[model samples]
Target: MDECSATKSTSLETLVIQNISNVKELKSKLSEIIKKGKDYEFDVSSCVKTLIKSNDQEIVFLTVEAISELVKCDEKRRTYSQKEIISPILDILQKEITTENAALIKQCFRALGNLCCDCDSSRKIILECGGVPNIINLMKKYFSAHSQLSMYAFKTLLNFAIGGQEFTNAMVDGGVVEMLQMVVIQELEKEEIDEEAVCALLSLLSLINENDTEILYSDEINAGVLKVLTNTADIDVSELCLDILHAQAEHDSVKTLIAKHGGIQVVCSRIEQLMQKFDHGELDADQSDVEAILKQACDLIVIVLTGDEAMHILYNKGLGEVYISMVKWLEHTNYHLITTGVLAIGNFARQDDYCAQMMDDKIYDKLLDLFDVYVSFGVQMQKEHSVLHPIEPGTITKIQHAILSALRNLTVPVANKRIIAAQGRAAPTLLGALLSVEDHHVAYKLLAAIRMLVDGQESVARLLGRHKSALRCVARWGHAGEYAGAAGEAPRLLAWAVKLLTRGPYWHNIVEVDGCISSLVNMLVASHSLMQNEAILALTLLAIETLKNISPSSEHPEFDYEKSFISQLIKSEIGKHVSILVDTNCAKMPVEVAENLLAFLDITSKKNKLALDYKEAKVTESLKKFAESRQDLSEDLKNCITGVIAAISDNGKD
Candidate 1:
């Protein structure tokens, strides 16, 4: 009565009951529904419910078969309420699969599989109704008798597993892993194997998180299975086999076996073939083939070769096409392709000319846009605003980590810094990620990129100073993360802060941020050599400003002396900590660090009314060594240390 009320006609349920003995009539009625599916008002699903209970196997099989045709040929699975039909179909499958009704079972599976084909909601309904466990059992039971049943089963599973890693993990949990291993083993044994079966295995393998513990490749010897599969003749077989191997290759032994056993050549060959097909627009049946190869090849080559040996002969093997293909994949809709491709190209960062290659290819400009999109998208998602739909977090993390790493790679070239600075968005976009991204890995990589970008250029450092939020983020994280244990973003971030703190106007904001003083104080005492060195040098700058506050003509300091963080320094125990640092680790410290420490003492001792006693400088053992030793320290350090000691003992000078 809603819209198609005038089209009231014979329900398929009526025909089903009337033609209990007539296969011809039942087939005719069902065929009409299959043809004019929208024209019929028949509760065909109800007829399915009736015939499945009739104990008449032919009627039941015919009824389910008719429903499958209607579902398959139309948009019912996507349009209608799939739950009403899904529950009944699964009920028939669960009960009928155990009986001797092969035709009924096959058509029942076809019905359910067709229903699950087009909609994620329908697939989840099937899963929630315990349909996956049932179908997997049917595949196990009927696999030897008729492989097509298992093929259909796997096709449905493939549909269920399509959208993401979690669903794939669900499939693997529901026994698909063992089912796929068996199918691969069987396909290898047979003279005429089913291509659908191989595709099924590949599709399932695609869902396996490159690091899924639930689908452990080691115990199954899936590497050997995958190695045998790489020589396949079909495009999907080649594409998916390489994808699985690419994921498995994240493990060292698996990567070596795949590479050592000619798998690399097979993968490279498929890439060339697929690229040719894609270029010619000839992938009529192999729709996802080219993108798959790009994804798999990029991931495999990047991880297997560059994963362990980044700056070596592994990349020198004429990977020119591979590199080009990766840059091209940056335009792909799937950011995974873009992400993995970026990571692969990043491996070449250590190579001499690749940075130039990436620039010539306009990779950074593309990455600039990609970085902006990903960072903005990530910010929107984290806020969970009403109008915005969030992308999957795993994918966002992949993209962010890749962008930061690729940007980090670009910064490696001493010359590309100018290119990145020229892009205008590169610095701001990277700075934007620092404020919004939740993942610390991305933050670390972003910090490292910014560090390398501003390493030597005082002009760019001053440019970065205009963004107050960026400065606060850097200073805050640099100070807070200074004590971060293990090798992490702390070293690079602190290094950048060290450079920026004394650079220009950015120095004035330090007093605005409450902990900037003690942050530098703690950074000086940090265990990492780079952090320690940068920290002392940073304090050296601050101490110069402090000296100007005490005595203006004492030195021609460039900083605005009155607004300096000098008072905060007195409260943070600057003199005692510096002496402690010199006493405990002077010899272990770098020569430049030793030099900067001496410079820090030079000014603090020159303070007309010091916070801690100037007498403490005389007792400093490290200073005594630098004063007495013949080790030719930097003239600046020697003079600073000499002045501090001389001031400490003007009475003894006579």
Candidate 2:
């Protein structure tokens, strides 16, 4: 045979050896043979088949190693297709997974799992292998033993269900749901069972989607899972249970099961406990524990209230009051607890009545005060933690995000636009915090709040315009290439600011107009894609407004000065900046900018003064091309350009 054939044959023999002392040599040989391409599939398959037949557990374990290597090779080189080995390997794995050798059986499942990473073929293989039965058996027999093989088996089964609905149906049909119910009952019987078992069961349950709610609820699985989620003191297991319940809560039947299983009271009790802890300063104790509980509680509450039925139930049960009370505690001294409380309250305040009531209670003012505290703390913390500057360290950007979100929620337009107006430029502090913080979620939250503020009141627009330097600070650095973590949100915030300036009632004056235009022009020239898009849209809107505001009869003739402004706009550095705005994928330039330009050119044409003292070739060429290109020019555009041509001809006639 050729050298390649000889290498494959040698590697196949090495794969079958029950007592190979040199794992390194076996790995190297397999790597080389698989790298040889499709020809080596038969050799690798034959070796794996032989290893599966061997009774020795060590040899069975060796099959896992070989399969892992093959998978790695397929991933890196794509020289060998997994299709060649999948059927033969699964066939061998099934034959080896008998009850007599459970450990070896578990290892075989793991090997099959390594092959199943292909995702496409895994579901078919899993159903054919009775993967659910094997996984349930392993969960029952070996879950508490800290066996890595057992964990691998359970995890592999999880991958199958997570793949899609068909795989989930397979598990449900195979009684995996009943098995999980038994595990939950067993865990509940003991004051303490292995958290890993509970975690594994929760992971398995999380894979079930809305379609499987009937099967899970009919089997009584939902109630048992909720019991563990609400009652268990073990935070890890409790959190996992919450995750599963959250998924199930989307369905009406499953949500009813959660309520029947005492979920509402349990969740409320947990929130109350957290509040008490915060009130008594116990939140600082075992901070890791506090963080785990708070995060889990927040996630569960958010999920439970997400649906209309669930939210209606929560409101009837006075959960809104509890949320408001928690918002009050958010004003306390512990930054961590305050941050968590703020996040939770922000979500609760999304309800219109809840927000209105919170506003009536002056929650809006209190929430703003909380933001000030957070910023102060962040500054102090920064100083305390900084090695060079010795600056005051505060609650970081994440805390700032929570605080701003709460403020935004409490101070919404329907709730109270006046509070936001009073804050004036101080409101942009949230944007400033966003700039300083590295977290993307925090940055996005702040940007969303800014959008809301700009949407409500025009004074916020004037305030931002007055603070041009601050606006530039965020606009400039937010688009900087090196700054990672949600840099995109900054541009969105700038876009909102631009929208306010152009469309806002108060920012319609000429001075304010120029500032808004300049800010947009700067952002248009920036390198950030998100910022450029937002800037373009904003510039387009401003251009439209600028045209709409212009009239021949205005008391302030600046409104009638469209010709001079248009001339200056096209001639200035900002005019070239328009090219970047036009070329962007965002297509943000105002339709009015084009309309006004056409109007000015048409007037010049009609007045026979189109050639009046033009200096910039680019600008002159741009105008000339617009005149020459006759496609789809609006009536207003045609009339305006005709006016310009007539004016130029009249000048020539004179």
Candidate 3:
């Protein structure tokens, strides 16, 4: 009896029907549900179904508003979308937006906008149901008449666009790009700008451009727009504007215009403000956001700096705090910020005077110090199974490339070269990078920078020769393989090392590296005549140094020819490459190459069995041809060739 006679309570669904059937009662009941949202066990989709059937404006508005409130919860939004609320809600909007039902229309838009915020399916429904042109039209109509309604429209369109390329394209086809430009221009002209409206529109435009890079907004941009974009106090709005401007600046004309409108100064001013906030620890945004703002600012600077007008502006403005900020970013813990800082400063260093100024400020030293950090980090990463603080190896490698690229440009001036080489950090840091960074591009940059650093500076080469691993890396990189430019540059730098160090103890360091001998020999046939000449001379010096080091006497008379440096030199097939160069390009070959080639062959042949190896390589034939064919051959070169032939032929007869 107790089981059959349970306590009576009103079923909420029945109570909902009784209360919500009448229009006035339904409004009040919906308001209560909206107010005490989670307290009610309301069926939102059922209400949506009932409201879609009703023609009464108030009932539809109240129900959709209630649905909007309920769907704000993520789970309910997905449920509502799956229940097919989009087509019905869009139906209500399509019919009522035609009327002057501003209140109902705005409420409907708010509901659709909430649904589309992050719900991809609902967004697809809205797009498929032809909701874009409707929303954009309402946006254009209500932009000035009703600001709130226009904002709702903006939010809805942005949501739809966020669905990705298809939805973004739909909005663009509906002429939303021009409409967004109008909104931005209008906001800029306002006595007090509406930062929210401007931010939303700019964000939508950014999406449009992202989806379709061919769409350019540069023509609509003006001085007022540039001023507002660069001077905004709102961080989000500033970020949006920076993104839009970065896209537009892809066109060179826009870059010139922005720079002419005092773009660099204004942008740098914002960067300086952010930097000030950083220094005081009074951040208006999170740390990453602030750094992102700084990064965007620097990126814009990088692209714009490609223009003459921008460079001129930078030259005049002097980048007071901007320069200081970028230099600070070089030392930041964030590698992205470091890369951006590198790009900006690299662009700045395009001017010789700026390079000198940076050098004076010791900015180059800071870059060198950054390289030193990576060098140590790379070593640690290799030795430890797990690091206490792990960073991606690829990230640091990219930064190395960036830093090397900047250094290459910075060291272009001869005076800067001398100063950088004299600083004593450039040589080791750059050479050490060759071992730490295995990327071919980084190797190329490192080699070029070293080439410039050691162009006229023998001291720098000698300093680099001290890092044995660096020499070994250079030797390996100098081989004829992929990335031939890097290969060529590597030998050029090694040639510098060999030429200058052969007289000193450092020659042993160069000769002992695994591929050093072969790298030098490969250059003898290199297409660059000057490199060939340098190679010949460097090899001759190397041979002289090897013989001097292994010269036999009573004390150390037993020289193991198989284990000697000359043995390794012969194994490189230098005779074969030398024969090819002389036979084909003998007339074009320099007298110095001929002289040094003969000297090198004569020195190597003096060692046991090496002369036989040369004869086996047919070096005797090329040397005899050189002695007979070329009228430009000097008496000294002739004598050298004769001496080498006699040495090899005599050994062959033995």
- The TM-scores of all predictions, comma-separated, are 0.54, 0.55, 0.67
- What does candidate 1's lDDT look like per residue over 337-370, in tens digits? 6775677667766664777777776777887778
lDDT of each: 0.64, 0.56, 0.74
What is the overall TM-score of model 1 with all chains considered together?
A: 0.54
If candidate 3 were superposed on the true structure by all CA atoms, what would the RMSD be?
Answer: 8.3
Please write out the lDDT profile of model 2 over residues 129-184, one tens digit for every residue: 56566566655665444344555666666766667778878777777777677667
Give the winner by lDDT: 3
> What ranking emerges by lDDT with the best candidate at the front?
3, 1, 2
Note the residue pairs that clash in candidate 1. none
Q: State the TM-score for model 2.
A: 0.55
Candidate 2: misplaced stretches above 4 Å? 1-175, 178-200, 206-220, 246-265, 271-290, 303-309, 316-322, 332-336, 381-395, 419-451, 454-462, 468-471, 474-518, 522-654
Ranking by TM-score: 3, 2, 1
**Residue 157 alpha-carbon offset, candidate 1, angstroms:** 28
